[model samples]
Target chain A: MREIQAEEITSVVAEAIKNINFHIRPDVKAELQRALEEEASPLGRQSLQLLLENAQMAAAGVLPLCQDTGTTVIFAEVGQEVRIVGASLEEALQAGVRLATREGRLRHSIAVHPLSRGNSGDNTPAVVHYHPIPGKALKLFVMAKGGGCENASAMAMLPPLASRHGVGDYIVNIIRTNGAAACPPLIIGIGLGGNFETAPLLAKRALLRKIGEFSPDPETAKLEKVLLRRINELGIGPQGWGGSITALSVSIETAPCHIASLPVAVNVECHSHRLTEVKI
Target chain B: MSATWLKLPLEPLVLRDLKVGQWVNLSGSLYTARDAALKQIFDLEADNKQPPVDLKGQLIYFVGPTPPAPGESVGSAGPTTSRRMEHFIPALIEAGVSGIMGKGPLSQSTVKELQRKGIIYLAAAGGAGAFYGSKVRGATITAYEELGPEAIYCMHIENFPAVVAIDLEGGDLFEQGPKTYRKET
Candidate 1:
């Protein structure tokens, strides 16, 4: 069995947190740039330009891209043949987040209680989802969910008769109704055909797909393209000034569902789209 | 158009002069607060208790920034959603806050309140936290430090950037612009 020290995992988490704060991944950057080129609304183009500038400034100066640095969500895939040494894995991850919060100069947004409300100074005790995978290496993906777009996420279970057209209509309606509150030039993550809760998970997971990357399945890819065109047509321009580039991308993940159920989930992400990953 | 700057201890200014797209750089003493903090302030007002800060002509920033590291003045101090604070806003205006700074839409009631009180609401670019943080030169806690980032912080800013989202006439950029440009079938 391969043995990994607790300090090693802590270091990985620390670096991943720091990296996501300042530098958005390359694929994400490229997508935002592409949207800027196609944006029809002058205001939309301007908003995109500001977004690009924000990213550049954050990276060059080693500062946070958005004031809402978000709650740290960790998805870890642990290998079966590996043994954790030094300290409990959870504690090590929290320690890593604590170190990153201090060193990276990140915002501590996590509240101590949902009702009473108090900030956890270090941003520690990350939201961790662990899965045992068939591998000798551990992989972790960290997502920081800002409140603006995260508050707009929703899920609904439709009847089996809900057609692809119905699904499209539902999604478009939600985005239309939510408007700029979700932040225009948004990324929509749609999960279809899964159980209720898992549908949302699939939708969020789909967000990790490359910006503007089409699904491999022809039908799904066509849906993504059509939805992209329709949303931009809303003219919710950049910052909702009425524009052509309303949505940056739409990613969908699907799984088999019960014959009587059509579970759909929509997770909207702001232009910030902050996420990072590491394999150790 | 020439740019103008304002200092704290402000006197009432006509909202008529503020244009839809004009840029403004604000300075002087501003208080930091958001939804939770706003709610608390309103609750105190309801009980006839004095609020933590003297808000007459005071500028309240709708932000709950991240904790600054050991040596920085503040962390990405960007605006939070304005819609969430809608319920508390009219009361804040009634209580004498001259300005509110945040992003996104404001409630109709908020717009009305701004007009009635000759107040203003501004929008800072949503994601430009780093750029905005540079404008904050100093900060101090006047109340609710236990609330951490959500606490009411008295901040001194220099040349902070924002656009007039809601002027004294109840004209709101968010409502008017979107309605004009919304696509029709």
Candidate 2:
């Protein structure tokens, strides 16, 4: 088995966490550029212009893409044949995130408890999900999720009898009522067909996909297009001030589920889609 | 069209003249607070107590900014969602707040109170943190310093770009702006 030092894992996460905050993803930036060209409303166009300028400033490293540097989420895919050294995997991740939050000057946004209102101070204890893959390679996908959009995320288990249009309607309703507050032109990720917990995970994972890339499943790909149109048609627009481009893209992921359950989860990502990945 | 540069101590006349959908540049003293800080003040008020800062005629920006980098006025300071703080608007208005600054449309109750109190609601560009963070002239933690990013901060801001999202007349940009461009698919 190949052994990787825990310090290496921490430093990698440290660098990635800091950098992703400073720069918006290129795919997301390109979508914003396209939105600027296609946007119809005068105000929508102006908002897009400000976002583009913000991107330039952020690229200069003067400031990060957002202030609410948000909850740090990491998806670590570890090779089954590899062993981690120096510290436990979870401890390494926590230490890495803490180091980056302090040195990188990212905001410490994690709270200790819902009722106690204690700040973690160093932005530690990041939510981590581990997947085992074959071989001696380890990969990490990191996201700095902002509160406004994450607060808008939801999950529901629809009746298996619910039609595809019904599923579409439920998703649209979620955006119509909750989308504006989350920020827009949103990158919406929908997870369909998994069990309760799995569905939401699938949805969150869907958000990490490249913006505007359709799913391999033809039906899922078509559903993505349909939802994108239906959502943009809501006229929710950028920042919910209103316009033709309410959503930049709708990405979906699916998994097999129980025969009686048709679970769905939606994760709304704001225009400042901070995502990055690394392999080692 | 000429630009509107509003300085501190915004008079009632200026507030009245402002309408939904008009963009304005603000330069003056502002306070930054979000969920926790607002909740503290709300609880304080419920007990017939006073908050640390005098909110009278001041605008409260709903935000939790990163600590400043060296030689910079602030770190990426941008607006957070306003809806979460909607319930605190009345207490803030009662304390004589003249304006609210944040992103997204507020609920009807919040809008109604703003209209009644003639408090201006403004939207700084959401996700445009780098630009808005530069506009902050100075920032000092005023309350809840232990809360870190969620602390109440008094910020001296200049040339901060904001649109009049709601005004004294009950007109709302969030409602009107989107309707003008709605397309049936």
Candidate 3:
């Protein structure tokens, strides 16, 4: 077994958390630039320009791209071949989050409880999900999801008879109601055919996809295009400032569900769309 | 006549146009407080004790900035939801806060109160943290160190760009703008 020091994991995780807040990923940047060219709405085009400018400023001067640095949601793929030597893996990750909150100067957006609502100043413990993988390197996918886009997310359980059209209608309605509230030119990530909670998770996972990239399945890609076209028709515009392009792209993911249940979920990402992945 | 219009940034258009949201930004003073800080301000007022900072015609940002690294002004400074502080806004307005800066919607009650009190709620673009951070030329804590990120920070700003969400006359961009564009589906 390859031995990896827990301290090393902690340090890497800390830097990863910090780097994501301060920098926009190259892939996301490229996509924003492309969207600027394709966006027809003069207002959307302007909003995209500001977004690009914000990304550039944040990257160069070490400013946070958006104010809501958000909670540290870390997706860890642990290598079965690697053994952590010093501290507990969970503790190490939590430590990394603490360091990021304190040192990185990222916002402490996490509340202790949904009902009681107490602030957890350090933004810990992180929402860490671990999966075993056959490799020597640990992969961490860190995303800082702001509350605006997060608030726009929807999960619904439709009957088996729910047609593709029905699901599409629901997704469009969500964006229309959300209006400028979700910070438009959003990335609409849709998940179809999964259990309740799993469906939302799948939708969020779909957002990890690079902007404008398509699903491997032609059917899913076609559906994505249709949804994208319908959403932009709503005229939500950038910052709700008025525009033609409501969304930059749409991505859909699906997994088999119970024969009786047709579940659907939508996770909208604002223009900032902050996320990054690191392997160590 | 009851007076309450010392609030400099009057409306969304005026605020940006008058350069209240412009560069030169601000150098001398500003106040930092959030939900909890507002409560403390009111609590002190209720007790007939002086609130820590003087908010006369002063700018107050509704932010709980991240902890600063060694030798930094402040980290990732950005506005929090103004709607959350709706309950405490009237009191703050009455107490003489000139400008309120935050993101998202303000409650109708808060909008009415701002109109009555002649105050304005500014909407800094949400998720424009880095852009927002660039305007903060300097920062230091003046109260509630225990509040950490939510502590009262005295921030110096330069040409900070923010849209007027709530104006002195009760016009709110967050309300009127979206309501205009909200399609009947």
Highest-TM-score candidate = 2
lDDT of each: 0.79, 0.89, 0.73
Model with the higher DockQ, candidate 1 or 2 = 2
**Model 1: per-residue lDDT, tens digit, A147-200?**
888887888998899888898888888787665776667888999988977899
What is the interface root-mean-square deviation of candidate 1? 2.3
Interface RMSD of each: 2.3, 1.4, 5.3
Candidate 3 lDDT, tens digit per residue, B44-121?
Answer: 888877888887767788887655546768766767766667777766776787778776666677778777766766
Q: Model 2, stretches more than 4 Å misplaced?
A: none
Residue A126 in candidate 3, Cα distance off native in Å: 1.0
lDDT of 2 by residue, B1-185 (tens): 23478987576678988878788888988898899889889999999999988989888999989889998657989999998898888789878988999999898877887898889999888888888898888999999987778889999998888888998999998888778877755
**2 or 3, greater by lDDT:** 2
Ranking by lDDT: 2, 1, 3
Ranking by DockQ: 2, 1, 3
CA lDDT of A252 in candidate 1?
89
What is the TM-score, restricted to chain A, for candidate 1? 0.95
lDDT by residue (A1-280, candidate 3, tens digit) is: 8898888888888888778887887877777777678765553465577677788787863567776787677788999998988898899899998887767667777789886667787888688878899979888888888776788788889888887888898888888766467767688788898899888888888888888898999988988888888887665666654456678788899999999999999998887776888888
What is the C-alpha RMSD, rounded to one decimal, of candidate 1?
2.3
